[model samples]
Structures are given as C-alpha cells and as structure tokens.
Target chain A: MEVVLMDILGAVVTFLVAFVVGMTYGGLSRKITARVQNRKGPPFYQNFIDAFKLGSKKSAIHHGVMHHFGPAFLMVSSVMTLMIVPVLTHNQWFPNLNFQGDLIFLLYVMTFGPLGMALGAGQTGNPNSAIGVTRGLSQMVGFEIPWVLALVALMIQYHTTSITGLMAAQAHSGTWLMFSSPFAFVAAVMAMFGMFRYSPFDIVGAPTELASGPISENGGKYLFVMMSSGSVFTFAKLTLYVDLFMGGADNLLILLIKTFALYLIPVLYGVTTPRYRTEQAVRWFWGWPSFFGLLAILQAVFF
Target chain B: MMNDKNSQKIVDIIQNWARKHSIWVLAYGTGCGAIEIPPTMTSRYDAERLGVRGAATPRQADVLLITGYLTVKTMKRVIRVYEQMQDPKYVIGFGSCTINGGMYYDSYNTIKVLDKYLPVDVYINGCMPRPEAVLSGFAQLQKRIAEGRANGAQQYKDNLEWYRANQKKIIPNWIMPDYNW
Candidate 1:
C-alpha cells in the first residue's frame, strides 16, 4: 500500500511539473517567435490565461462519444509517458515509473494519443478533420523510422533498454550521447524537428488550409483540455530527448537550460522556412533522416 | 455550503477576467476591414500583447468580426457560423458598412443594419477603421466582458425567434436547426 501511494504521488508530481513548466515554455516560444518577427509577444503566462479562459467558457457540444473521449485519451497518454520517463538521473524528489517500463514500451505509449486523436477526428465527420488526421498519421510514419532506429542504436550501444539505465551510462561516461554517439544524436535531433511540428512540417494543423485541423470541430472546454495536454506532451517529449542524448541534468536549472536549448532547434528552423506539402515533408524525412539513422547504427556496431 | 458558493463566485470572477484578456477572434475576411486585421495581428500593431489572437474556426472563436457589408446570400452562411459557435461569444460590427451599410447603403442585396440579424457588442466606425480603432473596439469589448455585460450569446438565445425571422426573410432557401444550444 505504501509503495502504491508513493507511485501515485510521483505520477502527480511529474504531471504538475510537466504542466506548469511545459505551458511556460510554450508561452516563451510564442514570445520568441514574435520577437523574431519584430512584434511584442504575449506574456510568458499567456497560455495559463488561455487555459483558464477556455475552461471557463460555457457550453460544449459533441458529435459522438469519441469526440468526448478524445481529449481524455490524449491526456492519459501524456501523463502515462511522463510517469515512465525519469526526470533527473537518480534523485528522489520526483522518481519516475521506469521500473514498470522501458524504451520500447515508451515508444508505443507516445503514439497512443495521436492515434486516439485521429479516431476522434474520424468520428466527427468533418472532411478537414479527416484530412488533417491523414496528414498527421502519414507524417508520423515518415518520422518514426529514423526515431526508432536511433533509439534501437542506443539500446544496443548501452546494452539496456531502460531510460534510467541509459542516463546512468551517460553519467558514468562523463559525456553526453550527443558527443559520443554523434550520428544517433544528429538523427534524433533531426527527427525532433518533425516532432515539434513547426513550419514546413506543420501541415496537419495548417490553419490557413485546414482551419486548425482535427481540433476544428472541437471548442470551449474540450479545446481547453486538448491545449493543456499539448503542453504536457511537449514537455514529456523534450525531457525524453534530454534524458536520451544530453547527460540527464542533475538540477532543475540545468534541466531547464538544456531542454529550452533543444526546444530552440525546431522553433528557429520553423521561423525561416515556409511550409511543405504533406508528400514533400514525408519524402524529405525518409531521405535524409533514415540515412543518418543507418550511419548511427553502423558506428555503434563498429566501435 | 456558503464556502462552496463563495468559491464558485471567485472562480467565475477569475474565468471572466481571463476571458476578457484572451479574446480569440475568428479569422473570417468578410470585406476590406479584413486587410486591417493582418497589421493588428502581425508585427506592427501586435495585438498579441493585448492577449487577442486569431482562431481558425467558429468553435474556437470568442469574437466574430463582421468586417464589412453582408450580402443577403452570405447572411445565411454567417447565421449558420454564428450558431455553430459555443456560448459566451461576442460580435464586433466592423466599419460604417456594418453599422449602416457605408457606400453600399443603396445596394439592394447588402443589409443596411447588422444588429437586426446578430447581437453586436461593438461597432467600429470609419470607411475602414484603422488598426488602432480595431484595437480600441477590442478594448471596449474586454471592458464589457469584465463587467459581465458581454452576454450576446445569451441575448441571442433569448431572442432566437426574432433573429431567425429576420434571417429567414433575407435568405432564400433558408434551413437552420432551431437555436437551443
């Protein structure tokens, strides 16, 4: 019973941290993007206000049960992923649930929300929603190859699939995987560009085209939950990247600095580039990222 | 029991304050006033500082800006879009055209007055109001929201019959679900 209670506590803490920090980072990105375009952006707490405002809005209509469950499924996937990814290497402030899962399990868990979102959008009967889901899923297929290969290479290199174990390996080696397994780092970082889904790759929710994509039919509190889930999911993905490549940070400040730096990789790339058609984006990912993934694997095997 | 009600009131106050600040306008380019929106939303005027941004759909939009003259044909579509939006929504009648049809006053197809069809919380004047006027209109809407006076959605609900009657007269081949939600 005591162990179970601690697990629950850990999950709660992880979610809260992910939610707060994640939303702040999202607002900061908006601010940075605005500054790059010569505009004064909203406050760093703007997302918080938007979330609260959305939650407060009265009236929500649903097309079906799937529409109602869409955000719920997305939120669950986010919280579950957060629970399994270790926050700090070996500290006790907020231990993760990694003992129950591994890199392979996390790979499947992370995809759950998008699939659920697609299912929900499919049921909404909106053509735009359907198109967005199709584009998002195709893009998912494009990026997952290199991302999975990069992870497979690391699992082989470290001889363990556990995320905490990977972190420990980096700590013991006194170097980030980015420095040691540079190819995998390069491949993963390239894959991260797609994961962030900024411009060129932002076809899924291309507002000018699909009217905000799958969430076009969703509004009010439903949108509120989806937005919050997005913030949480963003944090979880960024943290996982940090733990895998950057030697996991020993402190909160270090974690913030590393994650924010990694976050900029996609943000800056999105700013300068125009959007890509879905097919073009899919082809681009398959061409270069897959090659880097193969090279990373070969390097690991030889060395 | 008293604390429960008090807490609910406090929560309402906070929600109202946030809603007042973060008004997501629906991105529908109805007329020439639509051109003025880009300046406000983008680099120069930077309406993001005021916590207002464009929402891609009526579902996500808090404010619907009727940018110019609405033709009889488009009025049906606008009504449908308005009904699709969730509660706690506002409408801003943009330009003299929306207020009194501007130069289009003589045009038979263009509606002379907008308020007959939808509840407009604010009306921005000028042939095409500048971005500053648009921003000021938004500021007034926010003030109305804070004071709990921006209940146009509720007003629509209460006066649905009158609105539908007016809407149907102008729109040939009218078909709309009854206003309840």
Candidate 2:
C-alpha cells in the first residue's frame, strides 16, 4: 500500500513539473518568436493565463461522444508517456515506471493521442478537420521512418531496448550518446523538427489555410484539455530525447538546461523558415533525415 | 463559512480577469478597414503584447471585429459567424463604416445602424482607423470586460427576437440553426 501511494505521489509530482516546465517553454518560444519579428510579446506566463481562461470557458457544443472524449484521450496518452519516460536518473521521488522494453512502448504511446484526435475530428463533420487529420498523419509517417530508424540504431549499438539501460550505458561509457553515436543523434534531432510541429512542419494546424485544422471545432474546455496535454507531451518528448542523447540529468536544473538547449534546435530553425506544403514536408523528411538515419544504422552495424 | 454566493463571486472575478487579458479577435473584414489589421497584428503595432491575437474560426474567438461597411449580403454571414461563436463574446464596430456605413451611408445595400442588428461593445470612429486606433479599441473592450459589462453575447441572447426580426428583414431567406444556447 505504501509503495502504491508513493508511486502515485511520484507520478503526480512528475506531471506537475513537466506541465510547468513545458508551459514556460511554450511561453518563451512565443516571446522569442515575437522578439525575432521585432515585436514586444506577451508575458512569459501568457500560456498559463490562456489555459486558465480556456478551462473556465463554458463548452456548449460537442458533435458527439467522441468529440468530448478527444481531449481526455490526449491527456491519457501524454500522462502515460510521462510515466514511462523517467524524469530524473536514480531518484526515489521521480521513479516513474522505468522498465525493460519501455522505449518500444514509448514510441507506440506517443502516437496514440493523434489517432484519437483523428477520430474526434472526423466526427465533427468538417472537411477542413478531415484534411488536417490526413496531413498530420502523413507528416507523422514522414518523420517516423527516420525517427524509428534512429532509435533502432541506438538500441543496436547499446544492446538494450530500454531507456534506462541506454542511460546506464552512457553513464558507464562516460560520454553522452550525442558524442558517441553522433549520426543517430543528428537524425533524431532532424526528426524532432517535425515532432515539435513548428512553422515549416505546422501544416496540420495551418491557421491561414486550414482555419486551425483539427482543432477548428474544439473550443472552451475541450481546447483547454488539449493545450495542457500538448504541454505535458512536449516535456515528455524533450525528456525522452535528453535521456537518449544527453545521458539524462542528475538534477532538475541540469535536466531543464539540456532539454531547453535541445528544444532551441526546432524553435530557432522554424522562425527563419517558411511553411512547406504537405508533400514537400514529407519529401524533405524522407530525403536528408532518412539518409542520416540510414547512415546511423550503418555506423551502428560497423562499430 | 464560505457560502455558495461568495464562491461564485470569487469565480466571476477570476474569469473576468482572464477574459480581459486574452482577447482573441475574429476579424470579419467586411470592408476596406480590413487593411489596417495586418499592421496592427504585425511588427509596427503588435497587439499580441496586449493579449490581443487573431483567432482563425468563430469557435475559438472571443471578439468579433466587424471592420468597415457591412452590406446586406455580408450581414447575413456576419450574423451567422456571430451566432456560431461561444458565449461571453464581444463585437467591435470598427471604423465609421461599421458605425453608420461611412461613405456608403447612402448606399442601398449597406447597414446604417449596426447596433440594431447585433450588440456591439465598442465603436472606433474613423474613415479607416489606424493600427493605434485599433489597439485603443481593443483596450476599450478589455476595460469593459474587466468591469464585467461586456455582456454583448448575453444581450443578443436575451433580445434574440428583436435582433432576428431585424436580421430577417434584410436577409430574404432565413435558414439557420436555432439559437439554442
């Protein structure tokens, strides 16, 4: 009973930390984007205000049961992913379900939210929603090839399918995987551009073109849940990358620094770039990122 | 003991503050006044600093900015958009055009009085308000929101029949979803 209670408390703490960090990162990105464009942006806590306002809104319309459940589904996926991906290394308070073969499970759990969103968007009977869902799924397919390949390369090189095992390998070797397996890190970071869904790869929710796409019909509380879930998912994905490449962090501050450093790759890149069409984005992913993934696999096989 | 009424008042205070800060405007660019919006949102003005941002759809919007003169044909669409928006929404009558049709005052198709058709929270009087004026207009709306007096959506709901009657007179074919909310 004590073990179960402690685990529950740990999970809650992990989620709260992830939520706060991720929301702050989101706000900072907005501020950075504004400064880049020569404009004074909203406060760093703007996202928090938006989330609170959204939650307080009265959601009067929902197309169906699926529509109502969409955000809940997303929340579940993100929280589940957060649980599987260990936040801190060798910490008693943050030990969140780090087991063998969890890396494989993580990949599957990450994509689960979008499929659920697709169903919810489909039920809205909006053509734009349908188009956005298809575009998002296609983009997912585009990035997954290189992403999965990079993970497979890491697994092969380290001889372990678990995230904790890989982290242990880095600790034992005294060099981050980013240094040792540079090719895989490069490929994965490239794939991270699409995963983060920044400007060039943000066709899924193309506001100018698709009227905000899959989330067009969702507002009020539904939007609130989706936004919060997105923040949580962002932190989980960033933490996963840190654990895989940067050898994981020993403390909260170090974890944040590494994750934020990794995060800048996509945000800064997106700012200078223009939006790519669906096919163009897919091809771009398949081109260089996939090639890097192949190179990473080859390097793993050879050395 | 904290009673239900006190708790409700506390909730209302927090909600009003949030609504005041984050104003998502769905710009219904009905006339030439639409030209000013790009500058207002972009580098020169930067309405985002004031928590005033553009929303893509009616569902996500909080303020409906009716920019310029609304013709009979466009009013129908405008009303449809307004009705589609969730409650606690505000409408800004942008420019002299929206206030009283501007240069198109004598034009046959243009709406002379926007308030007769829909509840408007703020009116910016200019041939075409500059980005500064637009920001000022948003600030005015924000002030109204903070005072809990921006009840345009509620007024529209309460006086639905009068608004509907006015709307139907201009629009020949009245086929729309009932205002159930």
Candidate 3:
C-alpha cells in the first residue's frame, strides 16, 4: 500500500513538473519567435492564461463520442510517456516506471495519441481535419525512419534496448553517448525537427492553409486538455532526448538545463526557416536524416 | 455554496480575467480593410503582446472582427461564422464600412447597420483603420471582456429570433442549422 501511494505521489509530482516546464518552454518559444520577427511578445506565462481561459469556457460542442475522447486519449498518452521517462538520475521522489525494452514501448506510445486524434478528427466530418491527419501521419512516417535507425544504432552499440540501460552505459563510459556516437546523435537531432513539428515541418496544422488542421473543430475544454497534454508531451520528449544523448542529469536544475539546451535546437531552427509542403518535408526527412541514420548504423556495426 | 451568487461572481471574475488576457480574433476580412491585419499582427503593432492573436477558425476564436463593408452576400456567411463560434464570443465592427457601409452606404447590396443582424461589442471608426486603430480596437474589446460586459454571444442567443428575422430579410433562402445553443 505504501509503495503504491508513494508511486502515485511521485507520478503526480512528475506530471506537475513536466506541465510547468513544458508550458514555460512553449511561452519562451513564442517570445523567441516574436523577438526574431522584431515584435514584442506576450509574457512567458501567457500560455497558462490561455489554458485557464480555454478550461473556463462555458460550452463545448462535439460531433460524436470519439470527438470527446480525442483529447482524453492525447492526455493519457502524454502522461504515460512522462511516467516511462526518468526525470532525474537518482531521485526517489520521481519514481517513474522504467524497465528493460522500454525504448521500444516509448516509440509505440508516442504515436498512439495521434492515431486516436485522427479517429476523433475524422468524426468531425471536416475535410481539412482529414487532410491534416493524413499529412501528419505521412510526416510521422517520414521522420520515424531516421528516428528508429538512430535508436537502433544506439541500442546495438550499447548492447541494451532499455533507456535506463543506455543511460547507465553513458555513466559507465564517463562520456555522453552523443560524443561517442556522434552520427546517431546527428541523425536523432535531425529527426527531432520533424518530431517537434515547428515551422518548415508544420504543414500538418498550417493555420492559414488547413484552418489549424486536426484541432480546427475542437475548442473550449477540449482545446484546454489538448494544450496541456501537448505541454506534458513536449517535456517528456525533450527529457527522453536528454537522457539518451547527454548523460541523464543528476539533479532538477541540471535536468532542466540539459533538456532546454536540446529543445533550443529544433525551436531556433524552426524560427528562421519557412514552411515546407508535405511532400517536400517528407522527402527532406528521407534524404539527409536517413543517410545520417545509415551512417550511424554502419559506425555502430564497425566499432 | 456552489450555487451561491457570491461564489458565482468570484468564478466570473476569474473567468473574465483569463478571457481578457487572451483574445483570439477570427478576422472575417470582407473588404479592403484586410490589408491592415498583417502589419498589426507582425512587426509594426504586434497585437500578440496584448494577447490578441489570430484564430484560424470560428471554433477557436473569441472575437469575430468584421473588417470593412459587409455586402448582403457576405453578411450571410458572416452570420454563419458568428453562430458557429462558441459561447462568450465578441464581435468588433471595424471601419466606417461596417458601421454604415462607408462609401458603399448608398450602394445596393451593402449592409448599413451591422448591429441589426449581429450583436457588436465595439466599433472602430475609420475609412480603413490602421494597425494602431486595430490595436486600440482590440484594447477596447479586452477592457469590455475584463468588465464581463462583452456578452455579445449571450445577446445573440437571447434575441436569436429577431437577429434571424433581420438576417433572413436579407438572405431570402436561409439554409442553416438551427441555433443549437
């Protein structure tokens, strides 16, 4: 009973931390984008206000039962991903579920939310949502090749399929895997661009073109849930990358620093770039990123 | 305690505060006034600093900005868009065109009075309002939101029949979903 209660408490705390950090990062990205464009931006806490306002909205309409479950499914996936990723190197309070072969599970879990969302968007009877979902799924397929190859290369090189095992390998070696497996890191970071879905790769939900895509029909509380889930998911993905590439952080501050540094790579890149069409984006991903992934795999096999 | 008037007032206060800070505008650019929106949203005025961002659809929008003159044909679509928006929505009638049709007032097919068909929360008067005027208009909407007085959606609901009558007078063949809310 005590163990269960502790775990529950740990999960709640982990979620709260992820939520705050993720929302702040989103706000900071907006600020950075604003500054880049030579404009004054909203405060760093603006996203929080938007979330609160969305939640407080009096009415929400849904096309069907699936529409209602869409955000819930997204929330579940994000929280589940957060639970599987370790936040700190040796923290008792943040007792998350880490296990052997969890890396494979993580990949499956991350994509689960989008498929659920696609189901809901389809039920809305909106052509734009359908187009957006197809584009998003195709883009997912584009990025997944390099992402999987990078992970596979790391797993083969380190002789472990678990995220914790990979982290342990880095700790044992006294150097980050990013330094040891530079090609894998390069491939992974390149794939991260599409995964983050910032500009250039943001065709899936191109606001002007697709009417905000899959989320076009969702508003009020539904939007609120989606927004919060997105924040949690962002933090989780960033933490996963930090754990894999950088030696997993020993403390909260270090973890935040490492994750934010990794996060800036996609965000800064997105700000300066223009949007790419779905086909162009897919081809771009299959081109150089896949090549790097192949090189990573070859290097791992030889070394 | 949940139903207590004071408690509800407190909830309203909090909600109003949140709503005031985030005004997602769905600019229904019906006329040449659409030209000013880019500058307002981009480098010059930066309406985002005041939480006045552009929403892609009616579902996600809080404010329906009716920019420039609305013809009889466009008004039908505008009405449809306004009704599609969720509750607690505001409408800003922009420019002299929306107020009394501007130079198109004498011209046939242009709407002279916007409030006859839709409840407008604020009206910014100009031949074509500049980015500064648009920012000011957003500020006015924000102030009304904070005061909990921008209940244009509620007013529309309460007077749905009258608004519909006015709308139908212009749109002879009214083919629309019933105001479900």
Q: How do all models score by TM-score?
A: 0.97, 0.98, 0.99
Number of the candidate with higher DockQ, 1 or 3: 1
iRMSD, model 2, in Å: 0.7
Native contacts matched by each model: 0.91, 0.75, 0.85
What ranking emerges by TM-score with the best candidate at the front?
A: 3, 2, 1
Across A1-303, the per-residue lDDT of candidate 1 in tens digits comes to: 988787778777778888999999889988988999999999989999999888877756768999888888899898888878888766666778786237999999989998999999988999999999999999999899999989989988988889888888998999989899988988888888778788879999999899989989999898989988999999999999999999878888899999999998898888889999999989988988989999989988888
Off by over 4 Å in 1: B2-9
Predictions: Cα RMSD each:
1.5, 1.1, 0.9
Model 3 stretches with alpha carbons more than 4 Å out: none
lDDT of every predicted structure (CA atoms)? 0.88, 0.92, 0.92
lDDT of 1 at B68: 88
Range of the 10 consecutive residues with the lowest summed lDDT in candidate 1 chain A: A92-101
lDDT of 1 at B118: 97
Return the top candidate by DockQ.
1
What TM-score does prediction 1 earn?
Answer: 0.97
* Model 3 chain B weakest lDDT span, ten residues long: B172-181
lDDT of 1 by residue, B1-181 (tens): 6569888788768878999989999855777788999998999899999999999999988999889889988888888888888878999999999998899999999998999999989989998899999999999999998888888888988998898788888887877776556
lDDT of 2 by residue, A1-303 (tens): 999998888888898998999999999999999999999998989998888888887778869999887788899999999999989988878868868899999889989999999999999998889999999999999999999999999999989999999999999999999999998999999999999999899999999999999999998788889999999999999999999999999999999999999989999999989999999999999999999999999999998
